[model samples]
Target: MKKIKNVRTVALDGLNAIENNQAYSNLLLNSLIEKNKLPQKDIPLLTEIIYGTLQRKLTLDYYLSFFLKGKKKIDDWVQNLLRLSLYQMVYLDRIPDRAVLFEAVEIAKARGHRGIASMVNGTLRNIQRNGLPEIEEIKDPIERISVKTSTPKWLVKRLSNQYGIEVAEQIFLEQLKPAKQTARVNVNKATVENVLELLQKDGLEVTKGEIVPESIQVIKGNIAHSHVFKQGLYTIQDESSMLVAKALDINEGEMVLDSCAAPGGKSTHIAEMLSNTGKVISLDLHEHKVKLIEGQASRLGLTNVETKVMDARKVGEHFQAETFDKILVDAPCTGFGVIRRKPEIKYSKTDKDVHSLATIQKEILQAVAPLLKRGGLLVYSTCTVDQEENSNVIYDFLQQTCDFIKDDTLASRMPEKVAAHVDNGELQILPQYFQSDGFYISALRKKV
Candidate 1:
């Protein structure tokens, strides 16, 4: 079973899966890589192309419009093929123009008509000759950001409403760039220094984490494929995500439950903070997802984590009242904070999705509230930055829930760089704030 070198061909399968089959981008890319068993070099290339195409589709299409100005008609495959090829030519400096077109022509011929292949070749060549059209003439920042960066108009508009033009534009621009590949060193397995030494020895560059002391940011390394990750030496995570566990300020022996734990990033972080002592029940809605928690716990050699495939909204039957010292509702939301990493969300997400997700967040929060013992802590967080999902949710909860108050611990815990944005007992991190995702976290304490 020889691996494939036709990166564009592999990427087209993924693009078509997203465009025609409604598959998620990440899942489809992973599936394509597995099926082809692409060599390590092509993995990043194909991923970058596929995601880059999806990320800047609007801008690519806008540029293509100028190329098609001669009333020269094109078909669906031609359009998609041109979009794919031109993404590399205009945006990616590493791939030479002729190479990108050659691969695209091969893909076009394999999957499309000869005429369409010619169309792709002409459009991409025209792009190289004419250069991309100037976008500064566009007056509206939303449209400008959307056109220049390849984000959707609807998303730019929504973000403008949420964060205003100046900040929202930065977020949109950030989405166009690559994200930091960060990982938290599992203190139980290796110290940050040890992980740094190991990664450096492995011919990789890494940095000490900007936030947590045990956290190490990988500046350049495939930690996932390295022995460091396999040995549970570290777990890939965003620096902003690591803040959730730190904000909790857990001691060595407190019981903590990561409700809705999936692909368990925070669940393991919490366990490490507890020094692998006491209990951490990682609960999710599916057995498959719970396995993610179990996997992380195993990798980190954390014996204290107990994974359960139970819904966070309906876990009362198994646990005693006031059983846990702390409960974390990393409630699922619209994922607005992470749109940069998952750019497809910009096009596919809707206002209705946010409302639906907010409803679930409220339900999960209320259900998990009783699980915490008196004086116990509850940290409600969402990757979204909307008021509806953040402060507003907390506000409505506190108006009636007399036993809990917004914990001021966050004010004291705020990093010097993050303090200016902390407001009214809630930390709303706009992505541009820390080169991180837009996150909302509020600490709540039971009256005791």
Candidate 2:
């Protein structure tokens, strides 16, 4: 573990770790930023370089391939250095090409032999001298989209099959852009208006969210460190995720189960909806994750959230039948919907992973189905646009159980724009749909 001092070095190291599957992009970048103690201004640049390089990795590689035609065994670090330099040179117009090339050569010399630094300099200088390879020349549509958008060809094809090619391309194009920073107002402690005013006073560019009524979209400045957030006035959550608690249709005095809750965003939201009158039992498989739920609950001054360390699939062993008034199975999936924030998912996940997760999602749903009280509501949601893990899973579950039916009232609980997407009580929200995470939410009700 050598020390990472500058933004470029940090970004390069982060990219290498992600490329080797040694770390996830989000976690690795955060760790690197903290370890380096980078300046606030430098943090954005570091984030941009790393995420931009990752978001357009295939495109960058395509551009590099034309230049590195004879090079067969390029070291991962050297390649990453080249990619980082090229990303800044191509995407970041604010930074001149001379500065990017100088940093690349300097970092290369510091880390590798002079010959390697020369090679790095030559590759980038050549790329700068002659523009990147043309992506439009690619004959295949899937390959063109994959390289153009830096998405995997398999993913492009899957989305294309699920959504038409046009919509899938739109989804890819949207994910290439940055994710919006939105937070849910803790209505128990502050009104959306009050939070907006306070955040604005603090110099944050803020506005009401488009989808969820309680959400505030942060246009600029980090809201997590604001006094309002410290006071539990709001919780940083995606606008789409805030819809999960709402879809659950929680009441003031009811036992709600967040079967797979971790880092408890939805659980705390449910607790707020309960107005501290009832308990929201949050469960996660790992002890550390359960602690995350507890930490969030404590931070929000929510005393009604009871956290448990248990596997969601084993809910039958711990709880009696028909116990909870409402349940949320925010089951894990392929995570294709959140690529804008975590670009690694595009290359890391596979079709096999999707099928495997679908199986686990179904198991979690079946395991929790009996625990809901007769006529109790259960909301199934995933941060993925994959139909197999979303609609297919819900449809299969309905076929297996006669006691539950799609809750038609789910539409009424959603925003008008989102409500129109609801079909048979399931809403598959694409990233292009509202510039939100590709999310799915479905409500099911057990027969009374």
Task: Identify the candidate with maximal lDDT.
Answer: 2
lDDT of 2 by residue, 42-147 (tens): 9899999999999999899999999998887989999899988998888889999999989998999999999999999999888878887788999999999999
Which is the leading candidate under TM-score?
A: 2
TM-score of 1: 0.94
Pairs clashing in candidate 1?
none
Candidate 2 lDDT (Cα, 0 to 1):
0.92
**What's the residue-level lDDT of 184 in candidate 2?**
93
What is candidate 1's local distance difference test score?
A: 0.82
Candidate 1 lDDT over residue span 22-93, tens digit each: 788867877898888788778888888888898888888888888788755666666777888888887789
